[model samples]
Target: MKGRLFLIPVTLGSPDYRYVIPEKVLEIIISLRKFIVEDIRSARRFLRMIDPRFPIDESEFMILNKHTDYKDLDGMMSFLKEGSDTGLMSEAGIPGVADPGSDLVLQAHENGFRVIPLIGPSSIYLALMSSGLNGQNFAFNGYLPIKRADRIREIKNLQTMARRGQSQIFMETPYRNMKLLEDIAATLDNNIYLCIAANITHPDEYITTRTVSDWLKKGFPDIDKKPAIFIIGIKS
Candidate 1:
């Protein structure tokens, strides 16, 4: 019999895992001894934070990141043939969404393994729910181009999509959050609504939806070095 794969969701930023992570999920995490994580150090830290008694030394961790090649995936699923249940964890939030774990999950499915997704905080969905924009139709664009010309074009494309009643969602590296914000403010129409959600689930969490014109008038917030999600759409 093939072992099952559990999709684990780590806390967004709050130090207390209990607040964002469910007890049922924690129970399943406690039962697993093997894991495929995006980052080894953060995965270990999260496990220890969830339960101090968690057997960090006894558990095995396989790294899956941008550099992981197709050949490496076979080894990631090796424990499943032995009927050992394995967990998949991302650096933060749920695995498989804007996460590298999606490739592993696809491999598991191909090998006839059961994939179970546990409930947890997703910054994208969280931002969408709070944005007061069109939830029925939305597109997660992942990331815009880093180059100024290309980024402006991408912004225009997203705005065009939004004009058609589809909400556009995207994210950027923490260090580049301010630059992206500037681009959005300058490139988008003044009447378009933009939501900036920063440090989601953390004490410093900030989420607001306002017109681009209003945002320009008030100036951008201090979102430097903080994880954030940006949504562009017309207010409903």
Candidate 2:
């Protein structure tokens, strides 16, 4: 029998895995000795966090990132074909969503392999759920451009979409979070609602939704080096 491909979900940043990852998922992760991972060190650290005695040295890890060649994917499935269940893990959150594991999952489906996705914390969904915005009609716009003019234009485009009854969800590199926030406050209308959810699932987590003008009055919070989700809603 061909082994299944388990799509594992790791904690966002919480030290206690149980708080974000399920017990069943932990057990599944422990049982799998072969994995296709985004970052080997991070993946090993996550396994050890789940179980201190996890045989890190004995486990096999295959790297799957933007740099990985598509030709390597076929070889990645060889272990599964030999009846060794393989795991797909991300640096954080679930694999295949805003992560590099999507290609592997699509290849698994094409090869008729069973794919199992485990539940865990997702900053995007968590932000959307917490933000009193239009959840029924929302879009996840992964990240905005880095260029000042381009980024501002994209933010305006998203604002237009939000006005049409859709919520816009986006993110930024931790170091550039404040820059993105500044562009948002500068470009967006005062009445358009914006939500900033930072350090989700971790201590010092902050989530708030306010109009652009209100946010300007309060000034940007110190989320410079924290993982965060930015959401824009048509109506508060």
For TM-score, the strongest prediction is 1
RMSD of 1: 0.8
lDDT of 1 by residue, 1-236 (tens): 78999999999988778888889999999889999999999999999888889999999999999889988999999878789999999999999999889999999999999999998899999999999999999999998899999999999999999999899999999999998888887889999999999998999899999999999889889999999999999966
lDDT of each: 0.93, 0.92
Q: Which tens-of-lDDT digit does each residue in 51-75 have in candidate 2?
A: 9999999989999998999889999
The TM-scores, one per candidate, come to 0.98, 0.97
In order, what is each prediction's RMSD in angstroms?
A: 0.8, 1.0
Against the correct fold, how does model 2 do in TM-score?
A: 0.97
Could you tell me the TM-score of candidate 1? Answer: 0.98
